[model samples]
Target: MLSTIATTIPRRALCVRTLPISQTRYASHGTPHYNEPSGYLFGEKPLPQGQKRKREDWELLWYYGMFGSMALAAVGLYYKPDTRYAMAFIPQLLTALIIFNPASKLGH
Candidate 1:
């Protein structure tokens, strides 16, 4: 008994082109895109080309004491009238107006 086999693989070399990457490979890599956000739980600071962002004042009094304790816990969860029609206190009144609107912004 005997056997023989032949193989060929050339349907235009199994086409998958998707081309258009010719900006000199990002001008030889000097900072085409690395907008500073390193590994491990997101951390990026990057701001000293003209220096700005420095919000202090005890961090706006700790975000105005976390918007007055989430506006007294959304007024005790809408002071119970069958949980105020099951409104669920609208995410603590939208997180107490987004932590008191940037701590009542003053400068930055």
Candidate 2:
């Protein structure tokens, strides 16, 4: 019975083709809006050249991380009498560099 059902089903013909980069609008802007009728078949939307996406859900995290670490470092920098303040300052600065990236932002 299963074999008969399998044999009864028809197969589809799949034809795939590629368009040249110069021929496509995407060549000008790296982002492909899945808002297009057929774009959903592709993957995530890409970042535009020299532009960025945001930290849609991570705004609170970033604020807490950035200013909190900065506060620690800033306090160490000004109030502390010793150069050991550099220790806290360094990690916070690096954290800012890593987390506060181009695409990363405050608020959703």
* Cα lDDT, all candidates: 0.65, 0.69
Q: How well does candidate 1 score on lDDT at residue 82?
A: 71
Q: In model 1, which residue pairs have backbone atoms overlapping below 3 Å? A: none
- lDDT by residue for model 1 (44-67), tens: 456779888778679888988999
TM, every model: 0.22, 0.25
Q: Which ten residues in a row have the lowest lDDT in candidate 1?
A: 1-10
Off by over 4 Å in 1: 1-32, 37-58, 83-108
Highest lDDT scorer: 2
**lDDT of model number 1:** 0.65
TM-score of 2: 0.25
The most accurate candidate by TM-score is 2
Name the regions of candidate 2 deviating beyond 4 angstroms. Answer: 1-26, 29-55, 82-108
- 53-80 per-residue lDDT for model 2 (tens digits): 5666888889999999999999898886
